[model samples]
Target: MAERSTADLALTLTRASRTPLPVQVADGIRALIMSGALAPGDALPSTRFLAQRLSVSRGTIVAAFDQLISEGALLASQGRPTTVHPSLPAHLLQQVSAAAPDPTAASTRRPASPGASTAAAPGRPDPVPAPAPASAPAVDLRPGLPRTTRIGDAAWRSAWRRAAAAPEAETGGLTGLPDLRAGIAEHLRLMRGLPTDPAALLVTAGSRDGLELILHALAATRGTLSIGVETPGYPGLRRVPQVLGHRIVPLGVDGNGLRVDALPTGAAAPDAVIVTPSHQYPLGGSLSLDRRLALLEWARNEDALIIEDDFNSELRYTGAPLPPLSAIDPHGRTVLLGTFSRLLSPDLAVGFVRPTGAALLAELRDVREVLGVRVSATTQHAVAHLLADGTVRRHTRTERLRLGRRREALLAAMLDVPGVRVLPMHGGSDAVIRFDTAGSHRGRAGADPEARAVAACADAGITVGRLSAAWGAESQAAPVDPSPAAAVGGVGGAGIVLGLARPADGAFSAMLPRLASALATVHHTR
Candidate 1:
């Protein structure tokens, strides 16, 4: 039995409007709650009482209450009166009350034209939305994370339900469940134009997992091999190798991506090289066809391997994505590492590796199982369901449109900001912005412009990835003049990686001015 409030609320319902009666009722209640007419702990009328007053079915009232409860607008409990959610922050309540119209004066107030509302009244000042909370972090633009808001509620629920229904160990194996591997293979073939056999695919947790597994397999065969990693690239890639006790050879990436010619020849050459050919990490540049062929040629000649990180290749907005390096490697020297992090979310941790052969696949599985490194069986099943049901494909389309819009917004906002160079993005989840502060401040404290910009962004609560930090320890150890103007990797100086897709809806546009202001700080003060 639930208690009911005696207070009566004024609500207007129109049968002529396209909006449903239940929705109208919910909106009316929400307005009252937001406008301070209904305070926290104030009881909501019982469904029966409200239904009788509004002349609607009890079911309709229930539906309205349920909607409000789902949105945290109202709180409901067993054997207790339904009331406004008390846990809501005071600032939010204040914001709503400030924005909402006066309920007592509603009947006396005359409707104003849309244009009229845009301007402040002659005697009364226009109501402005409350400022965002001071504690909230500014829009995070660090690369790698993706936006998952576009995933439809129905599709998400269906995937999770299917996952929940399936028994954990029933369908999973060491290299991931057979169904999931097959699903990944099919997805690759259809979306990436990479014809992969399920037998050759080994599902790992993510790109790092796949890389570690490959390193294990490589170590078993080659024994303590030296690996070439892209300099001023993903530090995790370098760190993962170091953890495995493999010697890291720092390789540089230019406008085209990892420089193949920079690799040592003969005895000094690394046994294998890891490259992000399909939109390089941190810096969003795709490997050129000539370089791809050259890389494959190098691998074939040295009898070495090329671990291709096909990260965010599927999210290319402009033209068709270039064929993956693995696709071009006819000698079976290329191994592809991919993940669902950008497609879906990082929490899935669902990634796969297309090994060079069955031998490598078997070795990877053995290493993974022996080391007890396995993704949750439930997550694998959910991802597999998404792939098989074409939910991922539909979601990818929506994500691409969203990413494109955000990228455009970021570029447009930074266009006028001094000393901030927006690099061209071929196709990837992130964009790079180089900072050039020449004559601002040249002292020891303000030597590196990239460092200054990163600190400024941090102070402003904007989380952005620094390009200089991406360099391997070995790369950073290289001799330099210690001058800020010393250009590295063809760029004038260092930059920051912006994950455009990470911002919430309507957040990117709102934070653009703040971002510009932050960049200006570094641009002007050295």
Candidate 2:
């Protein structure tokens, strides 16, 4: 229930016909047309009607309408009536229209598909939309904890300045920066507790890009390769290896992270294992130390490569920093992949990969250059400076505290609303909450009661990424196991992952009552 905006108002005014009044008339019309006072194709009152209403001569109203028409902004006609031009002032139109529902619907014979290209949508403002229902639904608290607007302008400015000043050659076109490798190696040594040589470091566009490079490098390394991916684990995360023709085995993860003891041997044993040891996503949990030790042993015993995704390692709030699996891999069998997206921001487009040995590292670097997957030296420099200046590290400390408190508040408010259980947020910007039906762990079906809750929330103008979207949106997935003993899991009830980071200040504080009211009347239906 949004209040009418000022843009919805119309203008009622007249001017003397003897003198030119272009500015006043334009301003008046602008206010009306921009405001919804006059909609597209909506007829305007006759000149005489406006003139009499404004206590001015009909000639003046005619002159104003004539001027508006001449500017190609307003459509004016005597018998047919006049209205705002459908396409004038494109920017302002986008602002209003971005919020409008399928404008093309009226003209089409049938409704267009949601992803139809014929549908028109314009670019949004640079800053993330205000959290409290702006022109659109607010608070898209989904998992993956994407904080698109989290990166401060100061950091962007510095990064941009460095990027703008650096030579293009430094970005793997030949003029490489040895100092960057040195600094990066030192930083990883201290922060990630990984001992590595500077020459082994190769900057990558992202962790996924790093993964792609690994797949490309490993494509023919050993005879037929099969990799293991955690089930319901980051769907987009496993696509790189799969597209490269590697067979994917589904590995189950519980509270201990990926079950190392569950590694299938013989043909089932994967040549590589991808695990997010530091804050496992979806089902948020850290890898237990014993499991971490076993994972190292599994890789060693099976003679496999372990891909450790240390994404979002810096924002740990509940416990001390856990050592990455790579830190414990003494046999040099693990390839460590990480990104600044979680800690710094996603737009930075910077990630790094640490290989096990100098030979593997050198080979990957050569492949990286051949494949053109390097980040610019200036970006590396800017992040280095920010880290050196203590801004990024300092920001991490503050955001962790703020996010922890906000996460708690969001969880409390959601829990108070009947049928909603807020999943704890121990590691990232979002708090995943489940409602309506039961979790997928329960062997039941038709738990669509959760969908009723989602529908109620949608009616109140909340947009969320649901459990189904998260599961099926990605193109690649771990293979389904058909073991006779394997229990078929049910799809979790309508679950909503709410991001505490995106809400406008105090928006979460204000949304609880509206949410609770909606939930109060929600009930399951077939």
Q: Which candidate has the highest TM-score of all?
A: 1
Candidates in order, TM-scores: namely: 0.70, 0.65
Per-model CA lDDT versus the true structure: 0.70, 0.58
Worst 10 residues of 1 by lDDT: 115-124
lDDT digits (tens) for residues 282-378 of candidate 1: 6666776778888888876776778888878778765444557665565667779998876787777889999655555666777877776478888
RMSD of 1: 23.7
Question: What local lDDT score does residue 496 receive in model 2, on the 0 to 100 scale?
Answer: 51
Per-residue lDDT for 1-526 in model 2, tens only?
Answer: 1111111112323343544554555666655454333445544556766555355567876788787787766775555656666557675444331212221122111111121111111111112222444543455554455555565788768766865677666554321356555555655643443445666677777788889887666653564456677654666676666566555666765544565666787645777788888766555667777778788777767767788888566666654345566655556677788777667767777777877655556557667667874666777777766655456555766677777777666666666566556654556665556654433323345335445556666666665555444342221333333342222122222455555666665666777666666565553232
Backbone atom clashes (below 3 Å) for every candidate: 1, 7
**Where does candidate 2 stray beyond 4 Å?**
1-137, 167-169, 172-176, 436-447, 469-494, 516-526
Model 1 lDDT, full chain set = 0.70
